[model samples]
Target chain A: MRYIASAVFVIGVFVIVTAVTTQHAAKLDPYMYDYMIENFEDDTHAKNAVAAILLDYRMYDTMFEALILLTAIIGMKQFLPGAADLRARDELESVDQTEATGEQSSERPSE
Target chain B: MSGPVSDTMPTDESIVLQMVVGLLYPFMLLFGFYVILNGHYTPGGGFQGGSVLASLFVARYVVYPVDDTDTETLHSIQRVFLALIVIAPSAVLFTGVIARNPEFRSLYLTTMDVLIGVQVGFGLGVAVLRFAFFQGVGKTWHL
Candidate 1:
């Protein structure tokens, strides 16, 4: 069943890849990129075109990215392990655990 | 109180690593400050400069070790900067609230960048300190 599912997924991906055409991206005006590149600085005052576009036009996406980072950090702080308990986070599977001092663990010693 | 766990680095020392880090850390700090101050006109900005500054602490750890950062102070600094990030811009943006100055917009951006750099630096410092403390290599703070 797993193999059959994998085969179907591969076929679906192949069909999707083959079906995409440039017609969807065909712009009415081909000079849009040039125009945007030239004008972004004038409008936003940012020297970097990429920064101008991302920060000027699409700041919300960046906001979401920041939100994700904060959320992950907060989640880790809240749920990483018990208070007064010290150990590497990934040491759950090993029978011999390194204390939070990280004296011994399955991971490389240098790490 | 759930304050930061203060940990001093171990006495184990390497002269070569210490010397190199001592030499490099100052330059890294200067570059980080430059990035923050010049973000409006240059390629680097608040986040980049802040990360660069944060790297100094990590390097110190690699050479010496304990994310010996004081979390309480860091938290306060982050708060202050976060306030600056909001207040500085809004004061300029809402022209009627403060005297309307033509140059306020550009000033706002530059100041915001500075505040952001400070905040990011503090934040990353806190993270490194916590990691060291929890990892158990860090010596607890004295005094």
Candidate 2:
């Protein structure tokens, strides 16, 4: 039963991907590349056409890419065993050490 | 608490490896910066350059595993870079400044590239350092 369900799910995903790719290819205008090449400098003011495409023409994608990096770091922090706890304890130890030294210095002048 | 792991791995035995990496370090850093700064005029961009920069940490580990990095500070700064990455483009897009001044387009492209390069470099560097610490090598901080 599990094998049949897994096979059916894989086939469904493949069909969806193929249909989307074919539809996308049929709708794409070949001359769009020519247009970008001719006017990218004027439109985006980038010397490199690829830079113009990445930073100007498709900027939202780059923004979300940064977001993904941030999210990955946050998630990794949660999984690393005892790392956060150790960092917190180190900070606390520094604070307590400072306080203890301060008390010793103050008591010495009075004594 | 954990056992007293040495602050730095015993790397004094390998003088040749240390010298070689020390010689190559600055050049690799300069190349990474060049790739990022010249992204507007070249094939390389932020992601590629950032990975190059992050590789320096791995190299440092290979030579001497030292948990000298302030991951807390790096964590904060990387998030700030992400915020700038999101804000800079949206501000330009919404304020319609680029439409009024074509020159701003070049400046914006350069800024985004630098911001992204720094963000990725620091983020990946922090991840690698954290992983190293998790492996029980830090002398002071136990994990």
Candidate 3:
């Protein structure tokens, strides 16, 4: 029952997204790119329109791309057992009141 | 409690070598930042730059011994710095989500460069620390 509900929810979301995208597609402004190119110097000093588009005009996309990179790093850290241990140990050390024992754990064995 | 590793006083020559490696580490870090900062106009970017910086820490561990001054404190510092590295990029993204401009754009590349530098620096530091702690020093005795 849960699987069926999840499948339905996923399909429902897909359908809604497709519908919205199709609607937006139909109303696309073809001249917008041309207009931006024509007005490039007036608005931004970028020599390359594409660079301007990516860095300035559409910097949000670039930001999200960076976010994706960050997410991948976080995901990698989570998936790696050693990283997980380090994270856990760090958290424990911060919260625990135990005195810093002079002895230190042996360094992790090199791969 | 795991007992402290026997404090073998590094000879003057060994200390000199370690100091040289330590000094070099900062320059390597600076170079990594250079790559990241000039990424907008140049070929190298955050990811590449960060990895290069991180590798220096690994190099440091390989070249030096895990002494009292360099082990636990350095490892803890790396962990803390890496945590910040993991957080800084997300914070920028969160700000973007909340601002919700119709364009949905952000001035995040600079932030990305800084965060990647931290991540690479800290991540490498941790890895080197772990390596030094676990593997002990290499066969080449500097002293």
Query: Which candidate number has the best DockQ?
Result: 2
Residue B129, model 3: lDDT of 50
State the TM-score for model 1: 0.61
Q: Give the range where candidate 3 chain A is weakest over 10 consecutive residues by summed lDDT.
A: A102-111
TM per candidate comes to 0.61, 0.74, 0.41
How many angstroms is residue B78 displaced in model 2 relative to the true structure, after the best TM-score fit? 0.6
Q: Give the residue spans of candidate 1 off by over 4 A.
A: A1-111, B1-11, B94-100, B135-143
Q: Over the stretch B1-143, how does candidate 1's per-residue lDDT look in tens digits?
A: 46654443445466777788889988999999999877767788778889998887778667655434555566566666666655554455444432344344346456656776787776776676566556443244322
Which pairs of residues collide in candidate 2?
none
lDDT: worst 10-residue window of model 3 chain B: B134-143
Q: For all the predictions, what are the DockQ values?
A: 0.13, 0.54, 0.04
Highest lDDT among the candidates is held by which one? 2
Better of 1 and 2 by DockQ: 2
Candidate 3's residue-wise lDDT over A8-82, tens digit each? 999999999999998887756869888888975444443446544654466566555545544554554455444
Tell me each candidate's RMSD, in Å, in order. 10.9, 6.5, 13.5
DockQ of 1: 0.13
Candidate 2 matches the true fold with a TM-score of: 0.74
